[model samples]
Target chain A: MKHRVAIISVGNTEYTSLRRETRSKAELAFAAIKEALDEVRISIEDIDACVFTSVDGFEGNVRPARVLESFGQAHNVPLIDVNTGGSAGGSGVKEAVHLISAGIYELVLVYGSPTFNEVVDNQQVLNTASPPIFEKPFGLGAAHMGSLYGARYMREYNLTARELAQVAAKNHKAAVSNPFAHIRAGYTTEEVLNSPMVAWPLHLYEICPVSSGAVAMLFASEEKAKELCDTPVWVEAMSSIADTFLSGYKVYKDFENLKILAQRIYKEVGIKKPREELDVVEIFNPFAPFELLAYEALGFCEEGQGVNLMKEGATEIDGDIPCNPSGGVLCTNSGISASVTRHAEVALQLMGKAEGRQVKSPERGLAHSWGGNDGQFHTVAILSR
Target chain B: MASTEFMNKEYNMHLDFSVSLGPAYTKWMKALGEKKILANKCSKCGRHFVPAKPFCEICFEPIDEWIETDGEGIVESFTIGYAKFRNLPDPPYVIGVIRVGPSAVSMVHWIAGFPYDKPEDIPDKIQIGMKVKPVWAEERKGDLLDIRYFEPA
Candidate 1:
């Protein structure tokens, strides 16, 4: 029998561009970690273990998490650093679940702090993740990969920049009410398309900004969760899949791993008609076109109709199934931390704590994230109240 | 960070890091230095791979055969880069997703040194499935850049 896991509480730092956040990386992470413990009225000594998630490359400090031993309260304890590109946060929580489920630890805290500063050239940071032999030599940034996918999807699905723009505009508009969102200008289609073009088929507004932030989530066994919190969101099911590290090796470009992941997660969670069954969704879409791709891949709609869902406003805050109720990654992207925020967002919604963007008494929710080379890695978790 | 809150430090590393090219890449890059194409083939599934990986992703089995190939491929898709990711110096350039030989996938690389006979014909010439060959750089250092770019075959 699988051990039941519950999310007791979550804490996050304000999502803003890296340049705007000058505090030390530890300070930023400590702020969120401290808040999570306070939410559960617990002290650092209470946690049994820690799962640290973040990219050391971004911090310019190698193995910074090790340096954060005492600050993370995992000193002298096994602090497994779950590093999976942009989805580290989600991966960490999954690790926490396994730790508790395997009877290794009763309580675990998943802490992630990914920081980018002006010191490193913002443009070069993302490409460093690419395998040097294949992708890095081309010097293509993350957005270019998005462009390749967006361009092909556009050609195959008859997608338009306007359709992609709608996603950006919608997410930004929604972020207007989200205090944590980094870019919340509420741009229109024209304004987004008019925004400086990054790569052909991708404009500035269509891509995510470099937001600096941290996220901390506390997880415990079902028994401990019930005692600690009135409403502990249960982890129903979780799955992660990876495509080839080299984008060139992956033949299909339909976000194939994500689609495979969705089928498995839906089956495991006993979800049918995900659009109707899941109360709310928190998906990662660093690029706007991906939102539509994810919608189709996740079975929110048919293979090519994700754009139609957007055009019809089927994913709006008040839609039948709201998506990215906390403005999604497009609005408050902190790269690595953004992924876990999805799970946290859904947990908040299920616990009736999502103050600004709560769905109507949501009972079940799905949180999703993808990262690495060419959407190479994906994590999906189903949560229930 | 506030405008007032900051520290600037310039640090240079005297040491260089190295990665094992593995058996597959060690042979592949060695061949690149020789202006030859070496690819890995899965003995189990008969699938071929360029920029050879250690194993067949499909079969998850170790590749046992290595094959030499004609340095030719076709453009599967193309995009023009007009901006940078962070601060990486990416100027305007055309990137083509090239499907080399009958290999299972395409490699993301530059489509430069275009052998276009006319300037106005560039777009019409660089269409999908257009046959192209490697434009070997004069000097070879057993690296990917050894073959500067792909050009019309």
Candidate 2:
């Protein structure tokens, strides 16, 4: 017998524009956790376990589990801090669901926060992801690696610079209504085309902005969920996959990791033809092009027809499949916190709590995260009402 | 095999010997010394390359043949750096992605002959379609540094 788990409530600290805010990353996490419990009509004592996620290097610190010990002290709960570059949030959710189903914990609190706005050299933090022995010695950073992929993608796909511009334009338009988005205004295709290119085939506007924020989710066993909340978003299925860190596998053409994971989740949830089954999608596309490419990679569309899906307004909020209605990474990037943010938004949508960004009658949603150099690691979750 | 090992000849130091940069990249620096940029001509795919590497990303086969690029290209994109890194030029220098020919990918190199005296003197330029050519150093070495920068064509 498997124990069913549901997200009862979601909360987050308001995104800070000014870099000089007094709150630390721990404070942000604590505040968001507090708010989440308050909304769910539960206390810290109710949480049977807690999972915190953060990229310690980005905070210019390490062993954040000790700092998060305070959350455990209040409730006397077992706590674990998961750090997996940019996908820890999704990993934490996966772990929380398993813990609940395995009869270990009844309620789990998942929280993630990053103080990117206060970092001295964000590039130095990002550079550490490269292997120290071989690649890091050459000073190959994430931006350079991403550029390499973008250039290769352009050549292989014969995608024009203007088509890439469309991604930026669409994401920016979606950000207009998101109050927490780092960039709020929509940009015209001409504006995006004219913007300075940060890396070849990737313009400044197409890239995600560094943001400081935290997000928290409250998960409860199905029995506790019914007693605590009126609307509980069900976790239909969740899975994570990882590839060699420095192996430089053929991720572009051989995206079987993501495809296989999607197929598995779809099988678990009894869905076919994901484009029609999934009403809302929140993919961790830090780069705009990946979102379009993922449409094909995930079997949402036929090969080489991803651009057509976007041009037809199929991915818009009111279209066939709404994507990134929360403005996504293109609007606000808090590093490892992105995974949790993706899950939280899906939970909100399923609970009919998403304001200004909700997709109507979203019975099923897909939330995905991909990180690690060369797009090697991934986590996928299927959420439903 | 034992008899052959016992009859070993005298070992002598060789002044000129090929160095393996990594896997494939055998003849590129030699071409650079002659002010030439070479890439492998995949007999299978017909794709040209530069800073030549070992195998084709597409066909995944050894690329033994080499072809010289026409050495004419345009700036696809560029960035004006405000910070320094290893082997990169100083602050306010332009690094651009230049399209060499039919290849989809562009080579990144620095821009030369730009007025860098004052912030205002910085060209209100750097368009995507700007034509540019590689500028080799006066004394060439068969290395990536052979082309000091890409100057306006």
Candidate 3:
């Protein structure tokens, strides 16, 4: 809180399925970094520090940050590597904010690498994330981890399959305008219901695809931000929460940890009404049901009333509190990159540069990211123009 | 220029590990072989942990007391796998979050031994908060798999 930090620019590479991706890891990093630097009209030498975010073994290389040339070696900038599973992207941004806010660095670059680019079977790798001795042998994967929440929430709230599909259908429709999205089928509610069920209460359309892409964001101190860019999205407040490593320890009825975290952060920033005060929002929804759960946890509506908000079209791009205008992680989940894009998308929306997915003259917004085994960690950031 | 062909390289890692199950997990796993479920109770907070925690997270105290449960649990939540993935079990398998006996925290295991006409009928057959009992394996190995799965009681 000593020094102020702001996001000046964001860079993104085109997204595609992991099987069809032609861009090499290094190439993807280069293109995204170049675009970000070019947008700010600066070179790598101008950056004070860089933060690389990705999971360790998912990249096939344990130290993926070292393998890629983030121009840190040539430019003599400190490149700090951060890994917190899927929330690594959000945690990396938090690190950059700390570096600038603590008066250590003026300008920092956070690169969200494609964490699942090298995987042959993503579920095999994701299975390793579970508690090896106890939970790993029960055939539990990422989708199954997500479905535990969907099944319990549906039961407690009497949420029908059609209601859950409508939420997924909303995000799919939003992805139609996102050029960077991997799956832009723009499926309807009926189509979502028709999609193959990967896990109970979660269909193929509700789950995120194994997308391949990269994203970069430029963070600067108050002075550097004012000097380099005209419209800088200011960081209002940001923090993350953690849970037990064992999935069994958590109660799957709701986002209990996220609700506690939102209360603390919202209280810190004096956000009385999250649904009214925030102009736009971006949520970490690798599973479509998460968005609805997050809506309740974020206090956008009363618990179990998320479906009502969706039914009324209140979260649409043109409606009040437009969420996931970038189509969210459901459409393009390049692992950590998708988490970082949640923040990057909110920044762009507040800066009036969201292109086709821009909300109407947004001044303040919120970005959230969830990761680790069965939502072990969650990061929430409040941003404003 | 964008190339039409992209070369891909394949690699594999076959690694094995032997993790030390400390005093708490050792006792819990050893009990499984005898068809018993042991839960360690935290003296400070009075919260019991199934798979027995060495210490209470909230109370921050080492747990030395333990209790033996009847091996019956209530399903808190469950998911039915309808699609097959590599290295995972076949479709129609159910994974349940069951709070065994008096444990404050639940443990995850497979839920089976219910009658169903088709694979798709599995989801409808199970319900949350349903009572389930352990189905012991023929050969006990002091492992989590000692109880093959949980069946409706």
Off by over 4 Å in 2: A17-22, A68-70, A115-117, A251-256, B1-153
Query: Which candidate achieves the best TM-score against the true structure?
Result: 3
Query: What is the full ranking by TM-score, best candidate first?
Result: 3, 1, 2
Candidate with top DockQ is 3
Task: State in Å the error of residue B9, model 3.
Answer: 0.8
Give the per-residue lDDT digits (tens) of candidate 3, residues A182-218: 9999999999999998999899999999999999999
Positional deviation of residue A333's Cα in model 1 after best superposition, in angstroms: 2.0
lDDT of 1 by residue, A1-385 (tens): 1899999999887877765666667677788888999998988888898888876676666577877644444446667888888877778888998888887788899886654542355557677777776778686777777777776777677777788788889888888877777887887888998998777678888888878887888999988998899989999988799877876765434778888899998888778789999889999988888888889889999888988898787898888889887878887777677888888889988998887777889998989988777777899998999
DockQ of each: 0.49, 0.03, 0.86
**Which residue segments of model 3 deviate by more than 4 Å?**
none
Evaluate all candidate structures by whole-model CA lDDT and list the values in order.
0.79, 0.72, 0.92
Model 2 lDDT per residue over A32-142, tens place: 888899997778887898888776655655666676543656657888778676788888888889999787888998886663544544555566666553234334444
Model 1 chain B scores worst on lDDT over the 10 consecutive residues at B7-16
Give me the candidate number with maximum lDDT. 3
